[model samples]
Target: MIVAILGAGPAGMSCANACLSFGLKPVVIERGDHLGGAQRSNFHPNLWMLGFPGETGEQMTTRLAAHYRELPVTTHYRAEVTRVAASGDGFLLTLAGAEGVRTLSVQAIVLATGTRPRATPALERFAAECPRAIIGPLSDSIRDDIRDTDVLILGGGDNALDHALFLAERGNRAVVCTRARFSARKPFIATCRARGDIELREHCARPELGHGNERVTAAWANEQRAFDWLLVMYGYLPNTDVLAAFDPAIRPALSAGGYLHVDAWQRSGVPGIYAAGDITDTPQPSVPTAMAQGLTAARAAERDLVKS
Candidate 1:
């Protein structure tokens, strides 16, 4: 059976690798130029480590990509899937690119498109003042231009702390402004605090625009404060546009707070369709969890294919 994977991130790559193990033909379509997806070019130099204190996102992506290279899967970079529709016995996919439009038929589909950042009002206002304000996808801010800027980061999650630590190490003055008390794991929080470069401001809300026209010049929590750059690390919202062509009966079963719904085996309501990674409404949307879900979905698909 021919299966089409909608992304090239960890989950999609893992799914393709699993399909190879089961002797199924897997085709991977990635919108980005690189294989790492969101992990590509998202941070300063020498800034690697998870909030739990382990390998970096780049490292994880590299390992996963290497594993995928060893598998029998076809990868198409710079390919964007414009449409997906149910076909007579499978699904029809339409892709658009510089090379022109291409269509393919597959017996099964795996939606691992993942999630993008949710933009907050604070970030919107900040961007107006300092054109350098970065939000959502971290990959856009990996230039040498951010070397000596005063950075204000919002949120208190693992990603927030990770950004703060990373920026601080790069010689940028990093300050964290959290709405609530920081509640990350003990070890991670401790590491953040130990870094003298990071200053924590607890119970502080993002500043509203003040005395600025184009970009955010100053922000006021209780008082006005100035910053050069702002980074928001609140969280991510799922990217589920490709699922719009599926039957409505399957829609509700696969949606939760804008994220896809999945069973323990990572199968969606649609028999031949599956989902994994941050796009799913899973409890923990970590890299490892996404990879595991991808493997599970691939195995379940293999079983169903054999039964047919």
Candidate 2:
């Protein structure tokens, strides 16, 4: 059986490896030239990857990439799956890549496209207009470029609080605003609260934007303040828009929040289609969880195919 894994992240890689263990051919299709997915941008140490303590995401990727290269799976980098359609108990994927367009048929499909930072039209406009406006989780470039500055962050999630703490540690003052009470981990919330350089505001909406003396001016809560940078870390949204390219009649189910819907076995609503990693509606998403789910999905697909 041939399985199509859409991504080169931990989940997709794990899934491909598991498929090989079951004597199945696996093809990994990646949108970028690199393998780590979003992990490449994460500069912080990943505490969740057991036995690899203190290893940053980049280091982890190095290990993963090295191991993955030793596998027999077919890999396609800088590729996009332009279309997917149902075949005889399988699916055909149309891929566009550096080598031009091609098609592949697989018995099962695993979606590990992952998630991206949530954004609004206004935020997009601000990011395009202001060089200092940053979005999404902290990256290596952001860390190196910003220091000892005033930052206004929007969100109440773990990411927002973590960014605040990190910036404060670097002597930057952070003002974090959210539309509701924080949903971040208690430890992050507590530490941020104890910090003198971090200001946490609840029930705060998005601010009106302006510019003053090369700084971004944020007006909200009946006050106006200018900051060196605006960080819009409004959490993540699953990258499921690719489903729209599929034939609507064969599309898998998605949650109201736009995440893929999967069962305990990692099976999707449509037959021969499965999902794992941040693309699925997992309650607590993490690196370990993604890898585990990937293995589960691959195993389930193998079992189902064998039985059929």
Listed per candidate, the RMSD to the true structure in angstroms reads: 3.7, 1.6
List, residue by residue over 25-113, the lDDT tens digit for candidate 2.
Answer: 99999988988777787777886899998998888888887898999989999889999999888999999989799999999999999
Off by over 4 Å in 2: none
TM-score between model 2 and native: 0.95
Residue pair clashes in candidate 1: 128-214, 128-215, 129-215, 129-216
Per-residue lDDT tens digits for candidate 1, residues 1-308, read 98898888878888888888877788998877777666655443223234435555666677667877877787888888877777887778888765579998988888888888767675666555556577753455364556766777777877788777767777887788788998666776898788877888888866774433322444564566666667777777788876665556444265647788888878887888888888899887767777788888788788877667
Query: What value does the lDDT take at residue 113 in candidate 2?
Result: 94
Overall lDDT per candidate, in order of appearance = 0.74, 0.89
Report clashes for each candidate as comma-separated counts.
4, 0
> What lDDT would candidate 1 get against the real structure?
0.74
TM-score of each: 0.84, 0.95
